[model samples]
Target: MTSPAPAPETVAHDDLCPICHLLLYAPVRTECNHLLCASCMAQWADASTLTRITPSSLDMDLSAFDPNYDPTPDLEAGCPMCRTLTAAVPDRKLAGFLEARYPAAYAERRVEEETARGSRVGEDGVQGMMILIGNRHRAERGGDEGPNKHNWTFFVRVSRPDIVKEIRVNLHPTFRPPRVVLTEPPFEVRCLGWGTFTIEAELVLNEPYGWVKDGMGSRSQSLELSWMLDFEGRGKQGRVRAKVKKLDGDADHPIDVDARASPVNLPHMDHQHV
Candidate 1:
């Protein structure tokens, strides 16, 4: 029998990155056996270099000096806490622990990685996508709520942009296919409706391609997006929460989309009509 997974609260302190004081993301193990976020390590490496050469007095100019010219090259990449030289290597064990113990944090990290990698677009140029549904009302009337207003968008463009014919996006069981063919990256559409649904996207590639036979003409693949949205209160006075499900792709795919709720004030809009 397997042991039960530890609660997030129980593993919070152990899983936190020392540098960020938050849950570890893309954690790496040091030679000193300490774990830190990959991003934190990168930032610390730069800061450590600055600390080594930075003059205490602002009057001094160090611009002419080479930043990479370290007096003690062997002592580079020291741990901020222990001051012990260390190397950053992915801690698979710690990563698994975080995935099991703190799934939300892990998911958030995945989203950030995807965004940093240009929306998870791969070498093949066929990549996963994120669909963002924003509250127009909240966007128009600025509030303490930040810019997004519960919107997150991700999508992949055709590899051979020149040869690509068209793209079709179908919102399962409800809306009709868009009248126009998508020729750009966004592939977005506008509609007024509520309730969660599946988004079926179809990509049509040009003919004479490697994947297609000479007589077979075009080639295509279908990707699906299924997510959830919730409304907490009555019409126009409620909040909206949304999240994206695991994308439909190969096992090794790196894209993971997530979202947070923003206040949805639709006093003028009626759900009865929707």
Candidate 2:
């Protein structure tokens, strides 16, 4: 019997937005089928004026009465490339393709935008830290099978190495009471397991800081993190960061956070059944 031919591969084109000259973000398609970034088109529409007005009379009082006086500027929108009047619509397929093909670029852009917005710090005087979790082994495999298989070693990391004193990682009932501890920077741990768990970290602060009531320290501030290991859109690994804040009554909460994974490394996989 002859073997069936391999399925044809889909190739992505190196298409760049004319305005940004880079991979499109939130791409939109004009009626002419040309693609452009949504933000870029919006900006062009605001800047480009369809009509220009000149007052016939120089007198300020009679300017309003002048026949040639047109107060409003025409802001009709058109394609920046072809100058064709068309309505831009969201191109979901192209958006998905850009995200999947350029995962690193998208992640970097997200980080840059977040940083520009000053989201790395909390208003409550708490600092921000990054938590990187993933399996290097699975990443190295570079195959479809490893991503789908659940048996892999996972790791966790803290970005602010200088402030962290100790890290305690605890897996649910599988690995209990004896929490894994690390006393240094790169507070990362590796283990072979699946599911979610709690992480607690002790911080080396400049002075005693926490919820103090009636001249007594009620609760010490700690960075508590929880994450789950599941192969969904996050292929082999992913990274997340949050701002740690000390709340009233000694409660700690992380906020103003972000998480991202590479679509290239973790492409959507199809399941096979026997």
Q: Using lDDT, give the best candidate's number.
A: 2
- List runs of model 1 lying over 4 Å from the truth: 1-11, 48-75, 113-274
Q: For candidate 1, lDDT tens digit of each residue in 1-274? A: 9999756454458778888687787677777878887666644553232111111221222343354322121123668879876555667687788888777768876776556522222222222121222122212223675332222121223323444334444443443322224555444444444343434433444432212111112222322222223222211111111111122343333332212221232211122102
Q: Candidate 2: misplaced stretches above 4 Å?
A: 1-126, 134-151, 176-178, 193-220, 231-241, 244-274
Clashes of each: 4, 0
lDDT of 2 by residue, 12-71 (tens): 455577887766766777777778765555445533322112211212222133443211
- TM-score for model 1? 0.30
* Alpha-carbon shift of residue 37 in model 1 (angstroms): 0.6
CA lDDT of each prediction against the hidden true structure? 0.40, 0.43
